[model samples]
Every structure is written in structure tokens, then in C-alpha cells.
Target chain A: MKRILATLLACVLLLSCMSFAAAEDKKTLTVWIPQYQFSKAEDAISDQDFWDGVFDPFEVENNCEVKVEIVGWGIYGDTFFTSLVNEDGPDLVYVTDNYDLVKRDLLLGLDPYLTQEQKDNVILWNTAPENANGEKVIVPMDDGVAIGYVNKALLKEAGLDELPVEWDAFIEACKTIQEKTGKRAFLQNWGATSGTSALMLAFWPYYFQAGGKMLNDQGEIDINNEAGLKTVEFLKSLLDAGIFTEDIVTESESVDKFAAGEVAYIVADLNKGNSAFTPAGIDWEYVFSLKGPAGYGARTATDSFAVNKKTVARGNDELAVKALMYITSGAVMDEFHSKIFYLPPFTKDASFVKDEALYALTSAHSEDVYVVEEFSAKKSFEDTLLANIQEMFQGNLEPQEVLTETMDYYNTQLKEN
Target chain B: MQKTFFSRRRRQALIGGAYILPSFVLMFIFNVSPIFLSIFYSFTKYDMTAAPVWVGLDNYIKLSQNKYLGNVLTNTVQYVLITVPIQTILSLLIAAFIAGSLKNRYGSFLRSVIFIPVIASLIASAAVWDTMYKPDGGLINQFINLFGAPSVNFLGKKPTALPSVAAVSIWKSTGYYMVIYYAGIMNVSTEVQEAAIVDGASPIQRFWYITLPILKPITYMIVTLGIIGSFQVFDLVYKMTGGGPGRATLTVAYMIYSYAFQDKRMGYACALAVGLLVVILLIHLIQTLFFKERDAK
Candidate 1:
């Protein structure tokens, strides 16, 4: 009986050790999501709760662990690269992947890891991620069109019942708002806080609406054409008139006053504005479709998911691809649509959008969505242009001089490249 | 016995070297090596991701073509000149005042209070000052409004933005330099002060002719460090104006950072950094020479 008991105990110990080893072999996946993902005040679902609810089944099914870290947006870009270089980079990084990151060879191409079914789920965008070698490495997960937001109560107080559809009338309404309320009229960001946000959110749409594009077929800047000049002059006039508040100079300073009912309107999408103002109980509405001489053009940004090269280098590419696939899956995207008010999900079956107001803004300005090549050259080009634009706004340089300097600077860059 | 004596001295020297070996190793690893490595990086296009590509003198040559280079340098030099003197003199004055009474409870309390800003984080101070400097609903503007004056856009207008940003730097640094000056003032030979007093010298006369001359070495250190700090000013400017309202406050340090990190022109940024280092080193050498000549006199 003693001999039998000893043999049984040894067998049990071997089984337990094997089980522990199997558990240890399970791969861990890390996803870097911005802290802002939880979105203003937890009035909506917290990012952790939403992801936990969405990902629990996946983790259980695969017997793998998922670690989600909420990185702040300001430091997100730096973290994205540094973490990769250090070899502990997340399996997946959630960012608005600037074409620059693609050019830098920091991300792995998804083509190899993605299955036919997964590729079928990909959304068609005006521009897809193409790395330096023109390989599609990242895919768009969500899209948002930049429209206008208005504090309706303030507008009503200014004796304007309708939002202005034309730029001239917009200026007139701004003057009226200032005259009545003794508050700044519109709050347009004139500074390059995010280097290109003011351009993307405010000025780029105007330039597009006026029938201007940054580049032509040969990849040369047709930037300072007639429409571009008109766009600049229009902004210059608005600046000279002092429609935007002095607070526009700082990057982090938002149009909080607009939401607080101190300013009339701001050039931000309804979804973007609502995330902040809704928590504060600010009654805001989307008022957009900025019509110019040519037509309406919208500011569109893609929130994308890119797999890290390090993940593939470590032979975890399949797992990383699966994680991205799970994120952009119909069910997860559908939930995100409702919670975050992102544009209709990319997956065809997950075309879920929550807010009727978002649909209204999207339908109103979605067709006019503008695209730009934000690759390696874009940062330097936009930086030079925006600095000169700031100079023009401050009365240090004329709009003509601003146009000349900006054109010359980027053209030189083009030649050099 | 002579051989034994030499052997004992050699052993003592080895023991001393062993005691300091770790510190010497650490100093080289942390400080000396990075300086040399950075010099090498200055000549190569390194984006931290890929292997560095050697570009000879191309990066340095690009500096001559930078259109805003002169303007940025002007902003940097103006900042250093304006902030260093004011910071140094003000700190010395405060140090002189607080040094005499450091023994009492109130005096110690004052020292702690003055040093609080020095101890606080630069980024945090910049953020707090951002709120304080706002034109609307800001502390400074609120106070200015009490006088029934029009609100000033301290950070918005070109004329005031640089000075406004500089004021924040000065406020953040004054306490730090004050502590340094106070330490030096504490070390002032009491015998000299007593002799001056005995010779019927007034307080002002003693401070000017006796105490001032004696504190020259500490003053040199404070000024040199202050100049370097002013040149390297970035956090406040980055958080506050971001070199704007139209490049009103774009310092050389901030530009270097932007080029390196934001633009990813690593070699060009390193070249700019090397240029800045050279300029500061030249100033340091000249200042050291002048101080040595004065001391020799």
C-alpha cells in the first residue's frame, strides 16, 4: 500500500508541473490605447470596461492574456516608437498613424498575417497605410468628419436663428455675436499645436472647399494657387477682425468657452465637441457644411490600428493580427460606434452608429471629406507653412509675403527630397 | 626601511584608487561617454531606429540655409541677456537679506518658502503659470482688471510674449540662485564684516566694497550657470507659447528639440546642438579667463 501511494503522488506532481508549463507558454498581447479613449468623464463607457466586456470571450477562447495600457495622446507618438525600439512594444498600437510612421518602417505590414476573410473585412478609405516601400501596414478602424459645433443658446441670444452656411455670413454672424454678448465670436485655432491640427481642422477644409489640394500628379505642391491664396486672405481677414479669441494661440487650450456658452461657434465635429460638452451638460448642436466658392469640404481623420514590427520579429505576428482583427470585428466595432460615437464602423456588418446627430453631420459633410499625404515630407512642409501663417496673422508679414515664403520653403524641400 | 616606506605609500595610493574606482567608472559611463557619442552622432543622420548614415559636413551646412536661424538666435540671446542679469542680481539681494537671519525661526521659514518654487517641477510650474497668464479669468488679468485697465494679452502679442515667458523662467529660477547665493553668503568671512564695522563703515558701504568683492567667485558660478540655464530654456516655452504668436519666443534649445524629435532631422538637430555647445563653451572659456585675470589682480 505504501509503494502504490508513493507512485501515485509522483504521477500527480508530474501532471501539475506540465499544466504549469502549458499556462506559462500562453502568449501575452499588449495594446496601447490613448487615455482619452475612455472619453470625457465616464459619461460613456470607460475604455477598460468596454474592452473587458468585448475581449473577455477572446481571452477565454484563446487561453491568452491581454494587457491594455491607456497612454496619453501628447506622449503617444514618442511612446509608440520608443517602446518598439526597447523590444517591449505592444503587439498593437492604436493611433492616427501619420504616414510618417509608415515611412519610418516602425510598423509591420499586415498583408502576410491577415487571412482572406480578415482582408475582406477591411474598409476602403481614400488613403490607406503605405510604408516607405508602399506596403499597406496599418488599417483604418474608425473615421470622423470635422464639422462645426455651435452653442445654440448663444446663437439665439445673438438674434441669429440659423447657422451660417457661407463664410461671409459666418463672419457677419460672428460680428453679431460679439456685438450682443460681449464675448469673442468664433474660436478658430490659428496656431500649430499638434503641428497640423489647425490646418486639418480649420484651414485645410477651407482650402479644399475652395478647390485647392496640396499636391498635383507629380507630387509637387500646387499649394499656393488661386484657391489657396483666397483661403489665406479669408483667414487673414477673419484674424484681422479678431473673430477668434486670443486663447487660440495655445495648443491645449480648446474652445471650452464655446461649450460654456461664452463663444458662438467652433470648427470641430459634433462627436469631438459632444464628448467634452455632454459631460458638462452643455447643450451643443452640430452646425456644419462650410460652403466656399467651389463647394463644401470636410476635415476627416482616421483612427487606425497598426501592428508593431517587433511583434512579428518575435514570431507573434499571427497573434497581433488576430488582436487587430478582433478589434475591427463587426461586434467590437459596433460597440465602439455606440460608445465613442465614431463614424460608422468599417466592417460592413458593423455599420452601427449611435447618435442621430452624428449621422446628420456625417451625411451633411461626409461627401466633402478631404484627404492629404501626411508622409515624411508633410511635417516639415506644414510646419514651415503654419509658422509663416502665424506671422501673417500677427501683422508681422503680409498675406502675400506669407504665401511666397511658404511656397518657396516647401518647394525647396521637394527639390531636396 | 626606505624600500618599506615606498611600498607603504604605493599601497596607500592603490587603496585610495580602489575607494574612488566605482565613482570614476560611473562618471565616465553616465556623463563623459554620452558627450563624445553625441559628437559622433552630430555628423551622422541617425533617427534612432535605423543605423546612422554618415553625412560628413552636410548637416552643419544646412544651418546656414535655415531662414529663421537668425531670428531664433536673437530670441535665445535676448532671453539669456535679459534673464541672467536680473536673476543673478535679484537672487544676490534676496540671499544677502535672508543670509543674515538664517538662525531664527522666521528666517528659516522664509528660506523654505523661497525655495519652494525652486523645488517644484518645471513642467508643473509652466502649466500653473499658463493658467495664471491667461487673458480671461486668469489671476494676473484679474488683478489688472481691479485697476480698471484693459486686459493685456501677455502671451498673445509679439511685444509681450517673450518677456512674459521670460518672467515665468525668472520666477522659477530666482529661488534656486537665491539658495546658491545664500550658501556663498553664509561662507563670507565674518572677520572682514567685523573689521568693516569696526572701521565705522555703514551697512551699504560694507556690502558694496567688502562683501560684494568677497562674493565674486560665487557670483561667477551663479552667472555662468544662469546663462546656461537661460540658453537651455525649453519646458516653459514649450508649454507656454510654443515659440509663437509668430515665432516671438522660439529659443535655440526648443528649435533643436523640435528638429530632432518632431521633424526627425536628427543630424541637423545634433549639428544645431553642437553649435550651441560650441557657443556656450566659448562664452564659458572667455568668462573663466576674465575671472582669472581679475583674481590675479
Candidate 2:
């Protein structure tokens, strides 16, 4: 009886060890994405549910577990960097630009793993800087072009038949809307804090329209020219005329007011137009961009997926690239952009948008939209520029002083870097 | 016998050290090490991605030449002046009033009610205050509209932004210091108060002569904590104004955050942090000396 019991115990131990080894063999690919609004995912219970459903098929096909952690945009950059420095970062991440990662040698080059079919399957923005060996480190995901959103109902109430396409006309339209309706005609959030490149939406398009150049022939940031001064002066004129109130410095969300039909016009990105107006069923239309001396120029933004170099060290680089490609694949991007109403930059020959006006506005401006290239001093430059512009609106600084001080600061940062 | 007793004491000391080892290790790693590391990094140009390069006095020189530094320092000092005295005086008065006059269930209830804001998180408090400070149809604007007043943007204007943020700090912290003062007041001897009263001292006179003197040490401690806390103000400014409407609400702590996190200029931020520490230490030293001189007199 004792011998039989010993044999049974040994058999049980062997089975338990086998199960433990099998569990250890399984690998988890971690991914971090910011919480983006899914305006049309009413059937999806939560963000996790939507993401898990999207990744479920990929996970099944690879027979590997995909760990997706949805992070808040406020702390996403800090979290990623902190984890990266600790050498325990996620295998894949959604980042707007990966220049810092590439410069630090913390990004895996996807050139080797990308098949020719995969390369031809989607459009590549190549916004992120090439690696030391001139390899692509980012896969483009979505593109956001700066555009003006106007409340059609409010415009109609103010007796405007068509939206303005020029700087002076836009100002006149704002005045007429505010004078007739007694509602806020225009407001933009200038108080977007750290981690947000808010000036791109609120100030860059206007600056570009005014014939400003972000970089000169010397390839240095040179926005201290006549156009830069004019842009600030014009914005200050709006504030002076009561078209834009002094409250814009703290107006962190113009979309909420726009969606509620309290504001007639706001300069924002493409995604915001659908995210706010469609869900609320507000009557709104998009203006590609207002025209100034430089003609139409809208700032375009492309956020992409990047594989961490640590994935290579862990021997999971191929799998990480595969997952990145799969997520950015044309069919998947079409489905994803349909839910969030974002402009999918990678996907081609797929149309999920049914709204004629939205489709026309985005497609018509695709060829002319410009993207501000990545620079070492971009964040500091934007931050100081926003403050100087705010100071101009507050009447503390002249438009000339605003441009001088901001440009000087930007130049100093460039020199130091 | 003396040698045996010394050995016994040494054994006891070893046992005590063993008991505290885990906590000491953690504290050293998290707190003590970072402070020394910051001091070292203050002299280097580190962005956390690449290894730190020695920059000597470069960061400090740039900080001195920085046009915004003067304004940021002035704003921090302004915040400290606005919050410290107001919160200290308000807390002391409320504590004295409750402990002296309304020393009953109602007093306890009031104490609890006053401390509610203290327990609330700073982020939540700032969010609620932001809503109240909004110009269009916000609670404060709606209230003032009934009296035929125009809407005032509290956070949008440079003149009102720092003061508005400071007001939130005062509201949230007055109760905390009030609790401390109340405890200190409760510890005051009844005999001393009785003696003063019997000696023809009025209520105010007794409080002035007896309770106030007894609470002097607590006052000094509270003032020190208040100065340190107000000087390092970040969360309120971060949540409320973002050091904006053009550097009107820029504090040193917020500047450090902007440099370290937003700009990724970690070494520059560390230098700024070290400068702030020296200023704080000097202020603490002055306060300590002043209190000591007064006590000696």
C-alpha cells in the first residue's frame, strides 16, 4: 500500500511540473495606447472591450497573449519614458513622434521584418526620424489635419449663407454671428498644458496661412519673420474686438461649447469635428482652412505605432513588428477609424465615412496639408510660444515683443541642444 | 559588572538596528538617494535618455539669464506671501474661537465640517474650483449675474489668476493647520488660564497672555511647514492656471516640472530644484533664529 501511494504521488508531481513549464513558455506582448474617444462604438461596453475585440483575432492567430494597457493622455509620455529608462517598457506603443526614442537607440527598426506586401499595403508618413542606420522606426496610424469647425445652425441664424474662406472674411463672419446671436462666435483652448502640442491646432494653421516658415534655409526654427508678427497681431485684434474673449486663456475645451451650440466657430483638428458634432447630432460643417497671404495651409499630424528596442533584446522583435503591421493594416485601420471617426493615414481604397461634407473636407485638403517636422526643441518652443501669445492677448506684451521674446527663447533652446 | 552592562546594551542596540533595517533600506533608496542624486545631476546635462554629461555651472548661468526666471520667482514669492500669512492667521483664529467659545457638540461638528476640505484631494478641489471660476454660466458667474454684475474670468486674467489659485490653497489648508492649533490649544493648562482670569484678565487678555504664549512653539512649527508647503506649490498652479495667462501664475515648482517633464531638461530642472532648496533652507534658518531670539528675550 505504501509503494502504491508513492507511485501515485510521483505521477501527480510530474503532471504539475509539465503544466507549470507550459505556462512559463507562453509569452505576453504588452502594448500601451492613449484613451481615444470612440464616438460610434455604442455597442462596445468599454474601451477595453473594443480593444480586446480588435486584438482577439490577432492574438488567436499568433497563439500569444496581447496585454493592452489603455493609459490617460496626461501621463502617457511620462509613464512610457519612466518604464523605458527602467528597461521594462511595453513591447509596442502608440506615439505621435519617435525621434526621442530613435535618438536614444530605444526603438526597433521595422525595415527588416516588414514584408514588401505589408510595405505596399499602406501609406507611410515617415514623420519620425530615421534611425542611425537610416531605418524606419515608426508605422503611421492616423492623420489629423487642422481645420475650422463651424456651427451651421448658428451661422444660419446669424443670416450667413456661406462660411468664410479668408482671414478678413472670417473675422467679419465672427462679428456678425456674435452681434446677431449674442452667443460666443469663436473660442480656442490656449491653456492646453504639458504633453499637448496645442499650438499646432490653435496657432500654427493661422501662422502658416500668414506665410510663416517654421524652418528657414539654414534648417533652423525661424518663425520670427513678418508673418509671425502678423499672425499674433491678428489674433490680438480678435481679442480686442470681443470676438475672442479674454477667457480663452483658460478655455481648455472649446469642443464642449461648440457641441452645445454656444460657439459658432473653433479651429480644431479633424477628429474633434466628428467626435463632438456627430455624437450630439449638432449641425456643423468643416472648413479646410482659412486663407491668408500665403493661401491655404493646414497643419497635419500623424500618430504612429513604434516597437521598443527591448523587444529585440527579448527576441520578440519579429512578433512586435507583426502586431504593429497587423493593427495598421488597411482593413483593420478602416474598421478602427470607422469607430473613432479618425482619418486613417495608412489604409487605402476604403471609405467608412458616409458624411459627404466630412469626406469632402478631409479628402480635398489631403494634398496641401503640411506637417511640422520633429525637432529637439519643439515642446519648449510651443510652450513658450503659447505663453507669449497669451500675454499678447492679455495686453501685457505687444505683438512684436511676443514674437521677439518667443523667437529668442526658441533660438536659445536650439543653440543649447 | 560595567563591562557586562555595556555588552548587554550593545546587544540591545544591534537588535533595534535589525528591527529598523528594512524601513531604513527603503527610505534610503527612495528618499535619501534621490536627494544626493539630484545634487549631482544639477551640475550635469541629463535628459534621462542619454547618459548625463558634465555641464558645470551652465544650467545655473542659463537660469540666471532666463527672463522668465525672475517672473517665476516673483510669482512663487507672491504665492508664499499670499497663502502663508492668511492661512496661518485664519487657522489660529478659527481654532481659538472654537476651543474657547463653542466647546460643545456643535463645536465638534463645526470642526469636522471645517476639516472636510482638508481631507479632499487637491486635484478634486482644483477641478471644483475651476468650475466655480468659469466665466460663462458657471456657479459664481450665475450668482453675480443676479446682482447685475458682468461675468469675471477669475483664472483667465493675469491679475486675478495667482490670487485665485492662492485662495484655493488657503481654503484647503486652513482647516489642516486649524486642527493642529486646536490640539495645541487643548494641551494648554487650565490652571494658567484660571490664574490669569482670577488676576482680572479678560477672555481676550487670558488668551493673549496664556494660550498664545503656550502655543508659540506650535506656531513656529506651523509657520515653517506653511512656508515650505507654499513655496513648493505645484498641483494647484498646474491644475488651475498652468503658469499662464503669460507667467502670471508661474511658480518655481511648476517651472521645475515644465523643464524636467515637458522639456525633458532634467539637469536644468534639478539645478532649479537645488536653488529652491537653498532658498527654503535659508528661510527656515532665519525663522528658527528669529524664534530663538524671541524665546531668549
Q: Which predicted model would earn the best DockQ?
A: 2
Compute the lDDT of residue B90 as modeled in candidate 1. Answer: 91
Q: Estimate each model's TM-score.
A: 0.92, 0.95
Give the distance in Å from residue B16's predicted Cα in candidate 1 to where it truly belongs: 3.0
Q: Which 10-residue span in candidate 1 chain B carries the lowest summed lDDT?
A: B258-267
Task: Give the CAPRI rating of model 2.
Answer: medium
CAPRI category for model 1: acceptable
Question: What fraction of the reference interface contacts is present in each model, in order?
Answer: 0.38, 0.56
Taking chain B only, the TM-score of every model is 0.95, 0.96
Per-residue lDDT value at A407 in model 2:
79
lDDT of each residue in B214-250, candidate 1, tens digit only: 8898899998998899999888887777788778898
Residue A186 of model 1: what lDDT?
Answer: 76
